[model samples]
Target: MTMSLVFRNEKFSPDRFTGCIAERYQFINCDFSGCDLTDTQFIHCQFYDRESEQGCNFTRATLKDASFKHCDLSMNNFRSVNALGIEISECRAQGIDFRGASFMNMITTKSWFCSAFITKTNLSYANLSKVVLEKCELWDNRWVGTNVVGAIFSGSDLSGGEFSSFDWHSADFTHCDLTRSITSDLDLRSTDLEGVKLDSDQVSILVERLGIRVEE
Candidate 1:
């Protein structure tokens, strides 16, 4: 917690950081609404303030059913967080931005629904542009070069996710499970695998990258 260190609107006592271990703490404009923070363990935490490029706002925070294990939470901001049923497991979370995180729950205003469970998290280079996160559980996450251009993640399970240099046509994996993930930079002829649930060697490595040649 160096250089213009800040911690505003602080109010915590749900066991006062349940399992404590927070290094480099700096929470500017902190609200921490409905904070439970089960098993908390934040290391090298500096919610963002790269030379006044300010972040760490956590507006409208709820963090329902919170849990962040093996945490580093690199470059955290988590803007507009409601974070329904939040659970960030095995976390390193590189470059975490989570732009305007909500995870939805309207039930009116034209109805809405969403939740989060973020598993095996690494999320390298994370920005999560246009984050939505539909039908979520998000398994075995790594998602290198993560930036989900218009992120929806429809019907998400994201099985065993690694997704190297992932783009996958920029999000909205319709009915996604993506079995044993790492679809080799998935490009199913412009990427839109409706009801996606690929298996069988990731469907022969995504139809051999369109050079199709899968025997037996």
Candidate 2:
């Protein structure tokens, strides 16, 4: 069969799209909600201006510049994929894997990526607002030129991560493990650090900059 996207409408909610293939198809300004795209493959597809189907797969595929908006993507797998310039808004993306993914211009707003396992991912120039990343693992990741506004990373593990020139006023690292994480000019007011593991130097820096008391 030909690899082309079909059936895109406002009222069309496609469920059960198992084993379908749509490689490198352009889906511009389309709406897909309450759909099931389990086991479907969209290799290198371009969805620059469209909301995502409620249920979809992006597992181990190349989705550079795909925009997903106002969808429920709970228990989805974005494991080991390259999704650059992607925009996800108002969605539930619980338990997704973004290991080694590179996002040069990704933008996400009002989205929930709770308990997602992200390792060595590159988030360059990504904009996130009102997004919840609670209990997620962001180890060894790179947040270069990322602008996080009103985004929460509570109880998340950010050990040995590099955050260069990131906007910290809008980013909430509440109760997250930032042990040895590199950051500069971060204004953390509402963030909690009760049990966060930090080295001596990092602890001293936090105490001087944030005025947080360290318990011996």
User: Of the candidates shown, which would achieve the greatest TM-score relative to the real structure?
Assistant: 2
Tens digit per residue, CA lDDT, model 2, 47-128: 4333553323444454544444333334344544554434443333443334444443324765434434445545554444
- Residue 121 lDDT (model 2): 48
For every model shown, what is its TM-score relative to the native structure?
0.33, 0.48
Question: Cα RMSD to native, each candidate?
Answer: 12.6, 11.5
lDDT of 2 at 108: 70
Candidate 1: 10-residue stretch with minimal lDDT: 52-61
RMSD score of candidate 2 (Å): 11.5
Q: Pick the candidate with the highest lDDT.
A: 1
